[model samples]
Target: MKPNLIAARKPEEAATTHPTILRTVLEYLLDKGVQPFVGDSPAFSNFKRVVKVTRVEEVCEELKVPLTPLDDPIEVNGEIFRKIKISRKVLEADKVVNLPKFKTHSQMVMTLGVKNTFGCVTGLEKSSWHMRAKNYDDFANLLIDIHRIVSPILTVLDGIEGMEGNGPTNGRKKNFGIIAVSRNAFALDDAICSFLGIDHLVYTVKNARRRMVTPEYEVFGSFSSTIQLPSTVSTFERFSRAFSRFFVKYPSIDKRRCIKCRLCEERCPASAIDISKQEIDYQKCIRCYVCHEVCPQNAIKLVRKLI
Candidate 1:
């Protein structure tokens, strides 16, 4: 099973999947005579540390399952890009179980099942996509293309506790207290959008609609919450391209809170951050917010230039 273990943040932060859920699913798969393994490639953090901090390793230990990082990349062609490298283990698996957290994303409106599969891209290679996709819609399309090839049979969304306001990491924990299962990730994400009253606000859902990928599905049960999306999430459907740069939010370092970890500098695709000086070169910056996403201290703040 692949779960969203993007960082070493605690399970309480809702940044990653809880170990309890991983265990429950692992046991069920074991009972079905399925040889299940747990794997993911965290974008910035070390895989061993992320698994340990999220306690996913504990679950794997208890279940006697093989827990490993998604390594040994193999090339595959997607509809959008050729020779896309994915973990060879993923392609060789008989069946895949996708487990994604319910969280608001600074780039995409939400990170659900489809986004979870992106973890298959293998470690730091993910950073380059941020530079290439360049926009929400393109990134959404890339995610969808990846989903098509790594197609999982089932997806279980963990909504019991979720992140809001600049998440996947670095956000507030929200108690949504709901769980959902689906056969199709696209439909699952679209349904959640309807539930959250942001059906059209998500670029993934919008592009999925255009591509006719999400099939019709009925949403059972109910959930209600006023989610605090990313600080700059308003840019998605509200403004014209010409004005987006003027109004779009960019990352700024709060030097007082920064710890000089250099993660922001190391992981930034644009090489715009200099922790020594606590500066960002906006001219070179792609506004990917990787610095903000990778920062452990939450020192990166979102600001608008007004120019």
Candidate 2:
């Protein structure tokens, strides 16, 4: 089996950092005679659009690797996942390596190696999962199921420069200056949470733990001293005070940052969001945090409230 290579993105570099990361990933694979393919399943948007925006195609061309799009739909357990696809080249290759950005999510707490795979699920179908999984634990299990199917041979996190505040997209970038890799996605995430000093109880990691999928695997690479992760902020602290019933932190619209674009309302699966009033109905909200994740303006924040 070819070793999977995961690379980290350094913080503070211009967008040019992607190509450098891509080169490192390709080099590692080429050295082992593994054919490489690159792709991701971004939420609420088309993969082609994200690749174009991120210039991933250009990087693939320069590296002489194939830029494969996941276009075929596969039904796994009657899920009817349309275009529920992955890079065929990658699946057929000796190994599938992942390159994920490091970042904190308004929902899921931190979007690291595992959460990054959500991009593999394909377009609009991704949002329907949000609707189907409705609550945090269910969503997390769904994520695990997806991970089981797409099973990356190895994962590398680009923590050199990562997002914080509210992310996956829509957050300020922070410099973590670390590159981490592991064959065990769970262990890698546990190590990352430890490095960041954040709580592992965050939904995704917690679910991974329950499933016993942690990073008990060996690690390779170096760190610039131990990375100081931000302290764990509880869901209560980050959620809006108004929507307390959901039991998970839901983002509050930052009046100053909010352009009232209604993107959050449109993407919300629970139909809990009321853009007209700019209020979320907690009873209806599932606390998926898709509202916070998809906001382009960084207009949403999680706030804690006294019960």
Candidate 3:
């Protein structure tokens, strides 16, 4: 199940996929005589620890289903990415079930079905991709390539409670209360984007349109809520190099809120953050917002480079 457990610690927070949904899906699969196992590679800690914290371990135990880390990377050369490493367990699986949280992302806009497959890359490789992809569109292309490879048979979105405003983590948990299912993830994402009135906004949707992977689709369900774009979205819209020099949005540390946990420094792919002195080197910063993504304290804030 692809829950957004990136920085979640509690079930009540609804930051990740609700455990109830996991249990229900697992039970339904079991009833259909499907030998299903749950696997995800979280960016923060060990898979077991993260599942335990999110209370997913209990459900898996009670259901007697295997909960695993999508590890042991197997190299696969893609059209856009060469020697890309992915989880062997996932590669060997008969079919993948895309269980994504309907959450807004600081970098990619929304972490929908197409974006959730990034978990298959495993371990630090996910972080390195941020460095390898030179810009927003590049990163979206990487996600698309991986999604095409994973090729999940079914996608079930946990849109019951959506996260908005600087998310994938550390955002408001909204009650959207809708579940979306589709076979083609691209179409599913496209439909959601259309429903949210942001078909032109999400990077993956834009890239999918360019590649023509997104097919004609219709959204049946009706749900309403205003999505809050990430704070960085405003400055990022001006993509021109000249505009970037003056209006770039960068991550800044809120020292008082920071507990010196060092998660951001340890996980920074660019190695731009120095938690010891509480500073980030702007020249080295890649604007991946990874520090913002992984920060447990919500101490990282996105600020404009220029007034």
Cα lDDT, all candidates: 0.87, 0.61, 0.85
| Candidate 2 lDDT trough over 10 residues, lowest sum | 1-10
Candidate number with the higher TM-score (2 or 3): 3
Model 3 residue pairs with clashes: none
Rate residue 300 of model 1 by lDDT.
94
RMSD values for the candidates in order, in angstroms, are 1.6, 5.5, 2.0
TM-scores of all predicted structures: 0.96, 0.76, 0.95
Question: In model 2, what lDDT does residue 81 have?
Answer: 29
lDDT by residue for model 3 over 1-307, one digit each (tens)? 5555664467777667778888888899999999998888898877778899888889999999998988999999766877778999989999999888898998898889899999999899999988999599999999999999988988988888888998878888888788899999999998888788877779999999999989887777675667887777774563454554557679999999999999999999999999999999989999999999888889999888773
**C-alpha positional error of residue 134 in candidate 1 after TM-score superposition, expressed in Å:** 1.1
Instruction: List clash counts for every candidate, in order.
Output: 0, 14, 0
Error of 1 at 227 (Å): 0.7
Query: How much is 288 displaced in model 3, in angstroms?
Result: 0.1
Model 3 collision count: 0
Better of 1 and 2 by TM-score: 1
What is candidate 2's lDDT per residue for 1-307, written digit by digit as tens?
Answer: 1111111212242211355566787877778887776655455455555555566656677778776555444555413223344434334555567677777665566767776666565555677787776666777777766666678877877777766665555556667777787776667877777555554446678887887766465546544433322222454434553443434445688878788888889888777788778888877766677787677676777665443
After TM-score superposition, what is the CA distance of residue 65 in candidate 2 from its true location, in Å? 2.2
The top-ranked prediction according to TM-score is 1
